[model samples]
Target: MLLYTAMPLELVLDGIDRKYNFKEIDVDGIKLIIEPIDINHGKIVRLISTNPQDYLNSELSPGKIIEFKM
Candidate 1:
């Protein structure tokens, strides 16, 4: 298991439906769900794994940076 840390980039979705609020991304072949907690502060994100075992084995502590690519 590996831990990733970095400053998370805020994604501004334009012309997107509110119903589709969550963002999905693939990291190292692992599918993760990025749920926005507070848009105003741009801090405190919830990273959810599709597999529960992966989530339990992995640790995403505070002060870790989150990076994204295009």
Candidate 2:
């Protein structure tokens, strides 16, 4: 993990900002990361759940489109 260089830290860490906007929302106790496609819909970026059974839901799969308010 050593960066053996004389370049400034800012220069070396450039372009770290995310271009796509991802929002975290909790629906029915399951947390999800969503990438908005429109005002009321988004594509599921990831699902955060502790239960292994929660991950089996097809609708919660990444890349699936879902509706959301706000």
Candidate 3:
């Protein structure tokens, strides 16, 4: 199963991580490293990958809705 969110990633992920403590996610057969970046007011979510070119070519790129396996 896959779950997608249009809401702010930080809000949704922070809450979910607090409850479940998940560190990574699998989407489209790729394992993404999830990290949080603190800015001035709040934190933003960052998804890291070893093959960044592949990641950029995937549906998980910027301006696309993020999808994750549940």
Top-scoring candidate (TM-score): 2
Q: Return whichever of 1 and 2 wins on TM-score.
A: 2
Among all candidates shown, the one with the greatest lDDT: 2
TM for candidate 1 is 0.33
lDDT of 2 by residue, 23-56 (tens): 9999899999999999999999999999999899
Q: lDDT of each model, Cα atoms only?
A: 0.47, 0.92, 0.48
TM-score of each: 0.33, 0.71, 0.30
Give lDDT tens digits, candidate 1, residues 8-29.
Answer: 4333334455564556655666
Over 4 Å off, model 1: 1-20, 36-53, 57-65
Can you rank all candidates by TM-score, best first?
2, 1, 3
**Pairs in clash, predicted candidate 3:** none
